[model samples]
Target: MTVDDIDQELLRLLSADGRRTFSEMAGEVGLSVAAVKRRVDRLREIGVITGFTVKVDHTKLGWGIEAFTELRYAGATPVSAIITSAFAVPEVQAVYAIAGDPDALVHLRVRDIRHLQQAIDRMRRTGPVVGTKTLMVLGSWNRDDPAPGPVSDER
Candidate 1:
């Protein structure tokens, strides 16, 4: 699906706030509400727009501790299975099959250090997990650049 200017505009507005009504999006994108709806449906059908979700504040929810765990597997273990098992745990936010020394990397959110330790213990028992290195996130700094504009002057 080739997204034109209007489609891109609709995506930008929707990405920032998915709750925006089709009428409101139409006004912003200078298209009819029906047109906007059609484009949105097309985007979904083509797998451009996945799903809309609310961003929860983990700190407010009493899950203040964030940690990244690097896991190394013992000889020739299936890393995908390990990642799937780790993600099955509620505390695990994200999992990645990585290269280099570590076989997988897991991002976790927990209530505290004790909770993190318990989760780690469960993960170690899952399979051929050889070792794990954990790094506690003390604070997070916003480092993402602004989203790309409609067209680039450099191009």
Candidate 2:
């Protein structure tokens, strides 16, 4: 599915704020409401736009503790199995099978230190994970932001 200028503009706008109405988006992108709706529908059908979600505050929701865990697996071990197991645990927020020194990097949010310990213990028991190094998140200086694309002078 090739995305044209209008589609790209729609995506940019939606990425900034997913909750914007179709009519509102149409006005900004200089397209009719129905046309905008059709483009969005097509984008979703082609898997360009997956789904919308609401961002939440983990601290406010009582998940105060955050940790980053790096797992080193055995030689030529399949990391997918480990990742699947990690995702099943409620405390796990994100899992990445990195290419460098560590086999996998996992981000977790827990209610307290005890919960973090339990999560680590469970992961140790899971397949092929030889060792893990965990770092407790004290404070985040920067929040996660999507990579901005190249500047265009279409407008």
Candidate 3:
């Protein structure tokens, strides 16, 4: 489906706040409410708007630690098998099969350091996992947020 400029603007607004009302979007984009609704419906019909989701603070929900574990598997390990092994551990949030030395990268959220270590151990023990390297997340920034302006030094 071809997404025109108006469609692009609608998408950006919806992505920033999924619960934003159609009327508000219509006002922002200079279109009638019904027109905005129709455009949005068309976007969904074409599968561009697959679904809406809520972003949560994992730290507030008792998940104090977040980490990424790079997994190296045997030469013959299938991608599906790797995904299955990672998903078996409940803490595994996302699994990315990449094209490099490490076969996959697994995102995990856990309650504490001990929980993180346990999840890593579980992954290591599963399937044809040859090696695993985990990196702890200290902070993160999303592109959706406004970028900081250039730094200046003057006194």
**Compared with the true structure, what per-residue lDDT tens digits does model 1 show for residues 1-155?**
59898888888888777899999999888889999999999999999999897767799989999999988888887766877778767889998988778988999999999999999998888878899999999766442224555754565
List candidate 3 segments past 4 Å from native: 144-155
Best of the two (2, 3) by TM-score: 3
Models, CA RMSD each:
6.6, 6.9, 3.0
Task: In model 2, state the lDDT of residue 49.
Answer: 94
Compared with the true structure, what per-residue lDDT tens digits does model 2 show for residues 94-147? 999989779999999999999999998888877778899999997664423466
The digit string of per-residue lDDT tens for model 3 on 1-155 reads 79999999999899888999999999999999999999999999999999998878888999979999999998789899999999999999999999888999999999999999999999999998989999999766675545657666759
lDDT (C-alpha, whole model) for all candidates: 0.86, 0.87, 0.92
Worst 10 residues of 3 by lDDT: 143-152
For residue 34, give model 2's deviation from the true position in Å: 1.3
Taking the candidates one at a time, how many backbone clashes does each contain? 0, 0, 0
lDDT of 2 at 146: 60
Ranking by lDDT: 3, 2, 1
Can you rank all candidates by TM-score, best first? 3, 1, 2
Q: What is candidate 3's local distance difference test score?
A: 0.92
